[model samples]
Target: MTTFSNYIPQSNPPLPPWETLPTMYDLPSDNPEEPGLPDDFHFLQPLLLYLTFQPINWNPELVYSAADLNLYYDIQHPLWYKRPDWFGVVGVGKLYKGQDLRLSYVTWQEPANPFVVIELLSPGTEDEDLGTRTESAADKPPRKWEVYERILRIPYYIVFSRYTNELLAFQLVGGHYEPMNLTHGCLLMPEINLSLGLWQGSFRDIERLWLRWFTLEGELIPAPTEEAAAATQRAIIAEQEAIEAKQEAIEAKQEAIEAKQEAIEAKRKTEQLAERLRQLGVNPDDLDEFL
Candidate 1:
């Protein structure tokens, strides 16, 4: 056997050139110019991310092409120009090359386009969201509905109003989007095996309209915060059940003691009666014989 110190160590190799190594830049915000997408936008991001892990081709923030410069569409836009609030593509890698960060997603550059698009209606963009034309035609883009239905040709489009707590979904047909009823406030996206709907509950100490993802069967997908609350609720229920069971056992024991006391009292009364009859010279045995 060779001794532990007998083996020789090899020299370490030199570091590779920085140019050969891949460089990744931070993701760009679509509404960087504006005061950012709004507080509700943050709330909507996670639900969009959760939808990607499903069986459908779900890319969270896929970059798609518009013109030339890689425009990373929030989810993935077909062109470099416009970006939907939340979008999904059915057949794209979650990440390119497991590390090839995308500068932008150009549909022409990518193999697929978004199957669905969601717009979070805010006070600033409410008009555009409702398909109303902008009065000034100088530098504004076309209405959102026209772009989503005609240009992008996204199969499904959803508009959620935080103020009204309402959701509207449209499906593409004959090169146009037709409004579809979301019965009981549930919109089912069959492509992704999920549904998009509004859940009226409190989150982060804020009680307001929350956009949430759901299963096809209308079960609200629990956020991390919601899951914790549910667990706590279950624990409380179990504790209550244990307390009730203990109380019931104590009540049963008390009832048994009371029953035994009653039996003793009744037997004592019968003995006293027999003794009184014996003192009165009327034998209790003679009375029993007559009866």
Candidate 2:
């Protein structure tokens, strides 16, 4: 049987689009000087990550997470740093020096390193994010991948692409990062007692697929806005129930008033009949025995 492949004139079959086009694997050169500026998606995605990052097992005061923060790692070269899209450091005070807010994260002065770092995929930064570059500039700081893996040894490194809605996660193992297999479209982090997954729901008045956190048991960690909406719905339901109860009480009261009126009318008719029997010279009291 002649197939579609046989219809081609060339001896070799044409390669698929995936082979010819540029992909995350073949991203551009890693030039730190030309770091891509963030767009609206970059701003929004990090905010979602920041809001839903509720580490249930950790104390609220100790769980600190932020987006677009410079993380200074090396003490020798204090100026050298990498600003991750979002990062979370557990077991550290939310305030710097336990007094005021921090401007940047300094590794040497901090109590602990970032437990996880997330990089939102931008076209210009994909190469460095995926560690495709073998080395960095001669006189400059190390690449982001090297800084996270070799220097800081962050426990988890995640890269998410909003354009493709793809999520990639790696865990530190034996001085190297090992890719983690997602279970049921979610990656579970037992340390945080939460799992990261794709949730197809509305956030910030926008409906789209979002990467949000869930409990290890698959319960959604609601944002503040969602909580407010749920509270409003509960209030509405409670008000309706109250109205129905009030109507029922009113109906019962009206029914009692009608029953009392009916009893008074019956008594008045009996008295009128007794008065008529006396006028006709018939004893009303002895009429029952005669009948």
State TM-scores per candidate.
0.59, 0.75
> Model 1: runs farther than 4 Å from truth?
1-82, 89-113, 122-153, 161-166, 191-193, 215-219, 275-282, 289-291
Residues 1-291 of candidate 2: C-alpha lDDT, one tens digit per residue: 879877857588899999899995566446667565566667887788888888999998998988888899999899999999999989999999889899999999999999999998887788989888849787889998999999999989999888899989999999988999998788989988988888888777778888888899888888888888899999999999999999999999999999999999999999999999999998899899988
- For model 2, the superposed segments whose C-alpha errors exceed 4 Å read 1-34, 137-139, 252-291
Query: Per-candidate RMSD vs. true structure?
Result: 15.2, 9.9
- lDDT agreement with native, every candidate: 0.65, 0.88
Candidate 1: 10-residue stretch with minimal lDDT: 64-73
289: Cα error in model 1, Å: 4.8
